[model samples]
Target chain A: MLPFVFEWQWDIGHGVFMGLFYLALTIVSLGVVAALAMTFYDLYSGKEVHEEGHGHEDPWADYSYAHDKADRGEYA
Target chain B: MDDSKFWPKGTTRCKPVHFGLWMLFCLALAGWALVSAFLCLYKGLNQTNMNDYFAFGVWIVVDLAIIALGAGAFFTGFMNYVLRREELKNIINAAVIIGFICYSGAIMMLGIDIGQPIRGWFGFWHANVHSMLTEVMFCITTYLIVLIVEFVPLILENRQINKVPDLHFFAHNLHTIMIVFAATGTFLSFFHQGSLGGMYGVLYARPFAARGGVLIWPWTFFLFILSAIAAGPSFTTSIVMITEIVTGKKLTTHKVKMLMAKVSGSLLLFYLVLKIADTLYWAFVQTPAMGLSPSVYYQAPYGTWLLIAELGIGGVLPCILLLSPQVRESYWILLLAMLLNCFGVTMNRFVMTIQSLAVPVLPFEKFYAYLPTWQEWGISAGVIAYGFIIFSLAYRYLPVFPQETKLNPTTD
Candidate 1:
């Protein structure tokens, strides 16, 4: 997916698509790096695990449970 | 007895032996597919029903069908992550796994579909930006990478596996910022899904497939994208329902399924309107410009009835069933509607890929029909077998359904 790949081009389609693609990749990588660094620092410092069971709440979590509610007639 | 003795711990499951037997049956199917794939490769595509006139054949149809069906992964990911549709979360993981299987399988089939598998890389190396097929190849491969990344955390979250400190941390961290990956996947999927239709549209020699459009993309490109996103959620619904039947567990709430149906229905309505308009334009403007009547394109066996099947039974019926709140809200009705929606999308892909090729575009050419040889079926069946095996494994190992333990708590 890199621009340097032989298939890569500098046309409008490539420019727009590859631009968005790379930006997303960069964000994800940065997030991973930040989390790893934080976890490593905590482990070495002998800090207790965060007491809050609040994991990174998934964006779709609540939506996911709605299926069961609908089945149970709770929504109606 | 311990809570763990309840089989899945959270819910009941079939006996291990029973599960193993089912796996064994799937393996047999896979074995048949392997043999078929070998025969097709060894004897060449000549072994299949494909001829010079219908070179694209059943393999392409199956490829396109699975790709379209697999669109659930990208679309659900998009809605859940980008659009902030929280209800989709329950199904997105399953969608991602299915997408991974479909894409990897399609890529494998392409390796076989090409005359020289090794030289297939030449398409990328030579870089034909003008060719829609090139765009499709690039986008699909890149998106497959994205799908794998999206699925990794899910695998890492497997009950026993998540205990490992490194994997656990990795999964947690990866998930914490999953929005980025989901965005990337959406972008990639949008292009590949369109480019697939663009591939057919660029066949200027085939008027039925060709159309006037902006830049290099034809109308089919946009139409294909609409149809995929429109029908994707329905496919996911169908799959989840099937899973429930097999597992005998209510893995999701009815509200979530209804939300999905409502979305799918609305999208399908939009898609249907555009599709009809496109068809009318093609019939009156495009086809006539090419010096052919609409009927001339469908000279029998693959005639207007095929159109009826796609547009009428598959398209109209499903849209009606899904759009009617009374119908879609009904459990059985919604299931039937979703089933029809899936069928409609598959038919759309089939028409675009196989039937388009089957119709001869040249003035001197005659219409042709093709059937997949046993070997061709083998490769396609192999894809199904692969999907079933992988999904079953993921379900068995991974805590894919976060609500499973909550909804079906053990009472020892």
Candidate 2:
């Protein structure tokens, strides 16, 4: 067991372990929340989202293509 | 009879009949697993070879091994999103899918291994904050959720699925903020991997498994983390290579594989150095301090050969081959090295879980050799079958390999 830390005290072990664990959970939950918020906003605002391989280009297409090119060693 | 519409754009798939046959094979294995699970649940723990002495058998070993192998998802995500290693984007999707398969499969195996499916939540409900297992349970389940969240974007990106405007915007938004999940995953994965090793390390009664350490964490804790990150990318790359061979298509560019190899080799090299030191210390100092010779821990069946194979052949040899620029360029050689690297980590897990328990602590107690029953083997095979089915489905329908179109250009 955590012999170095008292059970009641918020010692370094509990502080660091539980703190980081909760911090990670918060970040993940917040990310999902933000995505949901954005999705609803875009849907209600009547923004047109480009479907994959559709005539309209994907917003992330340029960045992804550049990454693909780089991975293929096409660019120095 | 065209399912091609559902396939990723510019990709070719086998005929439905051929894919169906493959699915049938995987389903057979799944059927076997179901029977085994039913027997184990109905007949109780007596259906398996596990006993009071060997509470952990093949299931635990496979669980540990796959979880370690699955480290690629988080590590790759961390690199691509957090470190801005954009080239990794080509392979990151595959890594995520593999991670999902591994984590979810592991949790399922644990559900059976725990012997009581109903009260399984007790571990979470009545939390033991002091135990390393609590940390592992919390992090693994939480990280699995993160992986699912990460995987959702890809699932939403499927050709047919992407057409829904709301889902499209949701996937896009998720992609934009993926760094947050990636960072969170990295944090969870790091701790769980370490806590698993720490669980073994903290077995103070089992001198074979116990180790001296800094603060609450043992050397095995850090070693587990290092080995997972090291072997993880290699396992992911190996799966990608196998998929390419099976499908007869180029999925990702060779450079992406090379980057993975480089990352794996560097981390592996770091891991090996410490692992060797840990072994040496355990053999010479730690074992003697416990009033037991290291040789006592390595009796017949768990002989010195296990150490030689784990460290020498599986560890050092793979490290050398992977780090060699000339050797890595050759496809088969690189694949062999990565497979060997994975074998090394799996062997390490086997040794930690099985061998540690096999050794007799008390003078009257005898060394117990454990062979898992058919039910155990079936369950293990089912995990592999599950992985194959999941990966196959993901690769077929999802836009898993971003570079797939460019790598194997179709001539119409």
Candidate 3:
């Protein structure tokens, strides 16, 4: 549905419909990527996590956020 | 309670033997459909009785019917995320699961309906940007992706599936951004539902289904969106109630069911008023303007009875019942009303698909009738069976109703 695609049209109908279409596709794809990255990072960082839904107790579970690579100076 | 090992925390399920028997029945249906599907594919559409007159047969009817029924997914999500109706959070997972089943099942059947599964992707590769059908194909395929995104977190949340930390974190992250997907779903759903109606409406030459509209969209377009939104929540509530009956457990609170019914009833009332107006205008104004009478539409095998059933029994009657506190207060009555409401919307689809084609625009042309071949029935029943199998599996493994544990502390 991209503009560069051969079938793309310059009219308002195609522009508006396809615009919203691609916008949604982009958002969902980005969300999936972010979730996958955070999951892998959390696993590698060895974050303390108690097993949930087993009716067990764990008050001292560790929670960590996936930090941005740029903020960690990866680009520098 | 031995299956408690697989059940969600603080909840109970039916005996596994009973569950297996239930699945075996559903699988038998699916197995029949699978054979029928292969016959359709290999032997071609000759396996069905469809012809030039009924190009869009039972399969399209099922497609429109289920997609409309499945609107509960987006509508419920819209309420929870966009409208922030926190109470809706309880039933949202079940809505998503049902939506997934309806849509994926529709797509699976549609693949065989086209009679060359290989060419199904042709719509995407060499798409027509201007065609309403192209819009429908793109939006439905995209929304199915969005539904998958919405449904995966639920699948991942299964007691066993979530044991993997990465999957757990992934599911949690997906939940955090669900608003994005929900809003996107609402956007895509609105168009595809409307476009499905638009497909019929654009047959301007066919006065039966065609109507005046705003801009490119016909009145049927808006009516479809309205009818779907009105019927969707009711369908979801009905499914939840049926599950409760079959399992002998209260999966959701009556309060939640009533809340959904109240919303459904209000929307249905709103839809009925407009639908009545649309029919009147189409019959009196539009049809007469085309030099045809409304009587031109009512033929043998399709009579004014269809319209009366769609509007009066299916629409107005259920609308009144669902709106009443007394009716909705009774669990059985509410379920019946929901069933009627669904019936009305499905009748609307059937009329649009079959009766529209049944009508003769030219006086020289004769009235027509269509009875789907066994192959068509086989495929259709298979779709229903697929929905049952998927939803059953989800209910057994996933925590579909968040309030299930709280509502039913113990089951005999």
Candidate 4:
């Protein structure tokens, strides 16, 4: 239950339940937001987003570089 | 008119006419679902056999089952991205599409099942935070959003769509950060899957479904999670195998399918051990404490055979078959084992939803039987049809199976 709702309470049950619920929501939302931010940066910076090279390249390589590149602002 | 350009590179699809016919058939089923949905919405819940005694019916059984089956997407993502089980990368896209279809379809069915579809958000608005259903509501809806986020990048990767500069960048960015979404999804899925079983387990009045548990969670909660992760990979693999059989092409390597089967079998074996222990305790200890014999729970139409089918034929048999090295190497045998694993989990949900309700709780109450009407069947058929159409389109157009081009190189 949202804290703003009339039925909402400040008890432990609502606290723990909605706490985890919102935490998950926040994480997912932030993930999407981060992607959007990265996308906008890539678009405006004249970076070329190539079609992923297929046929036996390490499939997990993209994910591996995401965070490291994000930290360095070099996602392109 | 040739759509070969749209096909994933190095892959071949059936002729357009043949694909069109398949789409038409799927659409017909969707039409029936639409009609069924319209009637249920216009005529109200009375269109089906559900009554006060049967508050949940076939729809809930299906909702729970597919959600369990769809766990493949999140679990597979978790394994691939988080655990770094790279072989799953070959099948992960297909898994995501299946998860999207399953969750979206189940939500639609729930919309119809609720009868008053407009008030569906009331579950969130006027929340009962203590209820397991409330948790299920929050987690399922939120996880569906995560699934959409996961699926969109794949859609953007469509051959023609990938040509767009901005869209290409967006999809690439999404893939770059997929681990975050995958972790979030795994968290959401774990709770919701458990809460589903916890909903039935907390029905203390219904001895058939109720169970003892660890602090703040029932045994069924853990069991449900275990069963889902066990069967989810198998269901995903089963779909891939079916796709191969229909297309006469190898979409993925044998190693990928075998890996999925092995994961499924190991998890299934763990689940069965706990499930059998839980069943034994429920029968000998928990049921008797409620002053009801386990025998009372298994009457005509809801007989002991359901237990055998669920646990024995579907459970242990599949576990053995899947875990066997020789069987895993044999394509058909592996698929059969996976199907049985999926069936076992579905049956677990069925009994939990339907049979649990069928068994009367009160001393004077009678054991009641429920049969869903044609409309109910129509709605269910519609969900299946929806899945078929979505999967067919994704397979035809998207690079769903990474190993596809490699496994089935075009000679020409």
- Error (Å) of candidate 3 at residue B66 is 0.2
Query: How many angstroms is residue B406 displaced in model 4 relative to the true structure, after the best TM-score fit?
Result: 1.1
- Each candidate structure's TM-score, on Cα atoms with residue i matched to residue i, is 0.89, 0.93, 0.92, 0.95
- B88-207, model 2: which lDDT tens digit per residue? 888888899999999999999999999898988877555577899989998999999999999998988889889899889999999889898998899899999999999999999999
DockQ of each: 0.27, 0.26, 0.13, 0.24
Candidate 1: tens digits of C-alpha lDDT, residues B1-412: 1322322334566667777898998899899888877777777777777777777876788888888888899999999888988767777887888889889988888877885687887865665655677767767887887788788888866555655666666677677777877887888788889988888777888877888889767888998998888888898888887887788777765667788888898999999999999999999988988788888768667888888888888889999999897886577788999888888888888888777887777668788777777788888888889888998877776666655555554575
- lDDT score of residue B301 within candidate 4: 93
Residue B303 in model 3: lDDT: 92
Give the winner by TM-score.
4
Q: Which residue pairs show collisions in model 1? A: A63-B86, A63-B87, A67-B253, A67-B254, A67-B256, A68-B252, A68-B253, A70-B255, A71-B254
List ranges where model 3 is wrong by over 4 Å: A1-13, A44-46, A50-76, B1-3
Q: What is the lDDT of residue B189 in candidate 4?
A: 93
Query: Which model is ahead, 2 or 4, in terms of lDDT?
Result: 4
Q: Which pairs clash (backbone N, Cα, C closer than 3 Å) in model 2?
A: none
Which regions of candidate 1 fall more than 4 Å away from where they truly are?
A: A1-76, B1-9
Measured against the true chain A, the candidates' chain A TM-scores are 0.58, 0.57, 0.57, 0.65
In candidate 4, position B23 carries an lDDT of: 99
Clash pairs (backbone) in predicted model 4: none
After TM-score superposition, the amount by which residue B10's alpha carbon in candidate 4 deviates from its true location, in angstroms, is: 2.0
Give the lowest summed-lDDT range of ten residues in model 3 chain A. A60-69
